[model samples]
Target: MSASSTPAPQAEGQRRTRRRTLALCALPVVLLLVVALFAPLPYSLAQPGETANVLGRRDGKPVIAVEGAQAQGRDKGRLMSVTIAATQPEATVRLPDVVRSWFREDRAVMPREAVYPGGGDTKDAEKRISEEMKDSQHKAVTAALRQLHRSPKDIHVKLRLGDVGGPSAGLFFALGIVDKLDGDGAGGGLTGGRTVAGTGTIDADGKVGAVGGVPLKTQAARRDGATFFLLPKSQCGEASAELPSGLRLVPVGSLQGALDALKGIRTHGKVPSC
Candidate 1:
């Protein structure tokens, strides 16, 4: 038989193999694109269910003005806010500082095991919560704020969800609550509007948590004209390592603590206009 007439099994097999290889390579690429476009990964491991309440209220009503509904479906905009005319330091201290410290240091300190390395799937748990509960607390808080601002009900306490990686945001969150209560405008009439930048996580009891990526965040905040940068007391030393010479690292531990820290910054640690 002529060469052309013979069946080419080897050639056909090679072609099939090439097609399979291409498909396999394409799968991961497609998945990565989806993660990037639709749902990004969480910055920290403090998943959704671990802690439920994030807002605080005063006088039987929400003290902060939140726009939770607006934040819905917005991945990065997820945040919690509290409405209070004034921050009460005693409320936070009422809880054991040791308990607070445990949470503060848990992520970085937890040891990994064989079954669930890196603290028994703790990272995985946090990742799941961050993904499934995208901006949930932010929406809840915003809705509550709107309701209280309009109706003035007897709720008296509020909390909302917030992001993780960006601990510096705690400063902004704390200042927002303070401005809402003390500022001339409704909810303090403070218009941060990307003017001032901050980092650190705020506890319901009003303590700030240490955050990673201090240098990058601080540089970004400074570039945006943030006069003050809020940092967790634990992370303060770490943050100093990355702080730009001109940037201010306002060390804080809790929401109430942040307010206290801010007073010190406003009085003593004022940064020169950039």
Candidate 2:
């Protein structure tokens, strides 16, 4: 080939070579970002029925039972019941606004960042979505507070936990802690005024889960004097058989449903005002 032709071919080859080089350099970075954005966080790892209280005993007996309740039809969920025998029997808990608000947004669980810089024409959308997730979680927690605050006379609580990503239980967990601090005494609303305790998640719409760790939670509630335990309907049959004496299992669907179910309860000769 002529010298001129040689130069032209060489130029074309160089251009193609540069393009390939640039693409090669960019590939690893894209892969790295994919991994970084999609990789799970250490703390994000979770297991089903892992966080429940599974001590397996009630009142020094090898058998401890908790109940779960659920109603058939739309807009209804579930409730939880527990029995336990413990030293600090008298306690009541209330739900706080912040905690309830977290569930209102429908994102009960948050895993690690999955895809960063995704669906964004610019980089700002990623950050915005992250912030929005945080805000929604906060609001869900707030909604919970509104429900628990409605009944300040009853405290010792029962709750049920569910599958992974079911952090809605966190809100109920907070309320349970509060009950431990404030027993039935007056202004806080958490009545039943006895040493009763339980566990279940609080949603904006007030749905409970048929959770695991029943044996443990039931023992905890009975130990605390929870004469009546709220449970989801689905679990009552299986859970009730394991309950000890002095504990009755009540099934409920939503939080409102549980409240309605409580209408018949006479805590201490006087009906509770919840």
Q: Model-by-model lDDT, in order?
A: 0.41, 0.40
Off by over 4 Å in 1: 1-171, 184-195, 267-274
lDDT of 1 by residue, 1-274 (tens): 6555755999989999999999999999999776565552222221111111122334454434443222211111111321111111111221233234346422221112311224324456456446433333343223334422532253332333333321224445445544543432332233322233455554434545654445455665555455566666676666566466566666655555544554444345433221
Q: How well does candidate 2 score on lDDT at residue 264?
A: 46
TM, every model? 0.40, 0.36
Best by TM-score: 1
TM-score, candidate 2, is 0.36
Error of 1 at 188 (Å): 6.5
